[model samples]
Target: MSDLFPLTVRDAVASRQGKRLVGPVNLDLSGQGACVVLGPNGSGKTTLLRLLHGIARLNKGQITWSCPKAEAQRRQAFVFQHPVMLRRSVLDNLAYPLLLRGVPRKSAQTEAAKMAERIGVSQMLDRPARVLSGGERQKVSLGRALICKPDLLFLDEPSASLDGRATREIEDILQSAKSAGTALILATHDMGQARRLADRVVFLLGGQVHEEGTATDFFARPKTQEAAAFLKGDIVEC
Candidate 1:
C-alpha cells in the first residue's frame, strides 16, 4: 500500500500529570531513510518517538498519515527501549505479530521460524522468551517487529543497556530492515550510533524540536547553538 509517506505533525503536544512532556513541535516523515531523534538525557526524545508512533496520547495538535487510518496502522510498528517479551517460547514471540495480523497459525509459525533464523536466534526458538538474555530478547523483538514487514518502524533506544557486541548486532538487524524498505524513526543518545545510522536528524530540547535537517548538514554544521553544544558533548537545558 506504501501510502504512509509525508506523515505530518503540526503543533503537537503531550502532557503527563499536568506537565508538558513533548511537542508544540512540527515534523514531516516523507518515507525516507532512517530518521534519528537525538538529545541529552530527559530531553523528550522518547516522548517524541511515542507521540509519533501513536503510543503517547496527543493532548494537542494533530498527527496525520497520508494514507487511510487502518492502512497506516497496519503498516506501522513500534519497538520499545525495554523490549516486551511474552511469557512464551521465542518462536511464539516471533509469531505473535503475525498472529495479530490474522495470519494462519501454521503460516505464522513458519514465517516466525524464518525470522528467528534471520535474527540469528533459531537455536533459541524453543526457549522461554522471558528467560532469554538481554541480547536474545532484543533479537526476538526485532524478529517479531520485522515478521510482518512493517513499512515504518519506531524504535526507542534499541541498543540501550547492552554490551558493544550486542549493540552492534542490533544495529546490523536495523540496517538490514532499512535495506528492506522499512523506514526507521529512532531515539538515541549515542552520538556515534546516530552518525552511523541517521539519514535525517531531529534534535529535541525542552520538549520541543531545537533543530532538524539532513543528518549530513546537522552534523557537519549545526545552525543552532544548542545543537552545536549537544554535538560537542556539552549538556543542553531548557
Candidate 2:
C-alpha cells in the first residue's frame, strides 16, 4: 500500500466562525482502494474533503503532499454533491480543465470525447450542459473529473440526488474506476452504497473520527456507539 502512493495528515484542524469543523485529527491514506467517510449531516465530512483537496485552509496542524501540489491536484479530482456546470456544451465543459492546464486543444477534445463515451453521455457532447437532466448533468460532471485520469478521486455524495437507476450507473462507473487503480475518498450517508463501494470506512462525528477500519468489520460491528446507532437507523446525538 505504501509503495504506490501515500497521504498523511497530522493533528489537522479547520475552524470557521468560532466553530471547529474538524480538529486535532490524524489520518493516513495510502493510494490503494476506496475509503468511505460516513456520518450524519453536519459531521464535517465535506469540510474534511475540502481540507484534503487544499481548497480550504487548515487552521492548525499540517497536511503535506509527498507529491507536488500541481501533480497532486492533477492526480486528484473532486465531484461535489451539487455539481456546477459551465454554460457551455458538454464536450467543452469536460475540456475546460485540460485547456486550463495547457493541454493541446485537439488532445483535450479527444480525451473529452473518450470520457463522454465512457460515462455514457457521448451522444450529448454537443448539447448545452445547462439543459441536461439531473442524471445527465452528473454524468457529465463525472466525465469532467475522469478526463484527467486522476489517481485520487474525491466524491462527496455523488449519488445522493440520483434515482435508483442513475445511482446504480454512477456506482458502476466508480467501481470501474476503482478496478483501474484510482484511490477514492467518498463521503456519503447511504449505508447500502457504502457497503457496495467502500474497502475501508472512516466514521466521523462532531468533527472527530470515531472509528476507522475495514468496511466489513466497521459495518458489522462498529466499535463506537455512535456508529452502531447510525447503522441501525437511530438518531445519534452530536
Candidate 3:
C-alpha cells in the first residue's frame, strides 16, 4: 500500500453552511487495486470522494496528494451516477476530455474510437449522446473517463441505475481498468458488487468511518454490528 499512490488524509473535515458533513477523519488510500466504500444513503461516501478529488474544500485537516496538484489532476478522473453529456455525437462526447487537455484532434478521435469499441458502443459513435439509452450513455461516459488514461479513477455508483446486464458490463469495464494499473475507488451499496470488485472495503456511517479492512475479512466477520447487518442483507438500525 505504501508503494501505491500514497494518498493520506490527516484529521480532515468538510462543512456545508457551517454544518460539519464529514470529518475529524483520517484515511489513507493506495494506488493499487480497487477500494470499495459501502454504506447506506447520506453516509458521506460521495462527500469523501469530492474532498479527495479537490472538488470540495476541506474546512479542517489536510489532504496530501503526495504529488503536485497538476500531476494529481492528470492522474485522476471521476465518474458520477448521472454522467452529463454534451448535445453532440457519442464520439465527440468521448473525445471531450482529451480535447480539453489539448490532445491533437486526430489522436483524440482515434483514442476515443478505441475506447468506444472496448466498451461495445462503437456503433453509436455517430449517434447523438442525448439519444442513447441509459446503459449506452454510461458506456460512453466510461469511455470518456478511460480515454484520459488516468492512474486513479473514482466511481460514484457507476451501475446504480442500470439493469443487470448493464451493471455487469460496467463491472467488467472496471475490472479491465484495474488490470491496466488504474486505482479504483467505488462508492456503492450493492454487496454483490463489493464481493466482485473490492480488494479492500471502507464502511462509513454518520459521515465517519465505521470499519476498514480487506473485503474478505470485513464480509466474513465484520467487526461492527452495523457492518454485519449490512453484509447479511438485514436492515441497519441507525
Candidate 4:
C-alpha cells in the first residue's frame, strides 16, 4: 500500500453563491483505518468528501496530503452515491483507469476481471455498464475504484439505495479493502453501516462538524445535542 497519510485540513470551507455550504473546519486524518462521515441531507458530508478528494475547490483554508500531488491523486479514488457509468462494458469501464495509468492492456484486463469477481460482478463484465441495475452499477463503480488498489478510497453513501444483499456485498468488499491496508473515508446516513465499518466518526450538522470521536464513543455518548438528537432519528438543525 502507498503511504498517503498525514492528511491535514485547516479551516477548509466550501461555498456556493457566497453561502457557506460546508466548513471552516479542521481535521487530521493521519491514520490507517476507516473514518466515517455522518450527517443528514445538506449537512456537508458530501461536500467534505469532495473537497478532500479535490473534486470541489475549497473556498477557504487548505488541505495538505503527505504524498506528492500527482502520486496522491493516483493513489486515491472516489465513488459518488449515484455513480455514473460509461457507455461500455463493465470490464472496459474498470480497465480504463489502469490503461490511463499505463498498465499494459493484458494486465489491466486481468486486474479488472479479478476486481469484478471480488465484487460479485464477474458475470456482468461483458455487459454494457450503463444497462446494469443500480446495485450492479454501484458494484462496478466500486470495483473500478479498487482495481488500482488505491491507498485511500472515498465513498459517498456507497450503499444508500441498495437492498440488503447488495449492501452486504459492498460491506464485505469494504472490509477486505480495510484488511488490505486501504484507508477508507465514507460518508453515510446509515448508522448501522457506520457502526459496522467506522473506526471513528465525524458528525456534521449545518455544514460543520458537530462532533467527532471513536464510533463507540460517538454512538454511546455524543458530545452535542445535535448529535444526540440525530442518533435518535430526530432531525437536528443548527
lDDT string, candidate 1, 60-151, tens digits: 99999998867887888998889989989999999998898799999999999999889999898899999988988888888888888999
Candidate 2 vs candidate 3, lDDT winner: 2
lDDT of each: 0.90, 0.88, 0.87, 0.89
Model 1 residue pairs with clashes: none
Total colliding residue pairs, candidate 3 = 1
Which residue segments of model 2 deviate by more than 4 Å?
A: 1-4
Q: Name the runs in model 3 displaced over 4 angstroms.
A: 1-4
Error of 2 at 198 (Å): 0.1
Better of 2 and 4 by TM-score: 4
Per residue, candidate 4 scores C-alpha lDDT tens digits across 1-238 of 3467888999999999988999888898865689999988889999999999999989899988888878888889999999999999999999989999899999999999988889898888899999998889998998889988889999999998899988998899999999989999999988899999999899888888778889889989898888888999997765
How should the candidates be ordered by TM-score, best one leading?
1, 4, 3, 2
What TM-scores do the predictions have? Answer: 0.97, 0.95, 0.96, 0.96
On TM-score, the leading prediction is 1
Backbone clashes, each candidate: 0, 0, 1, 0
**Candidate 3, position 6, lDDT:** 85
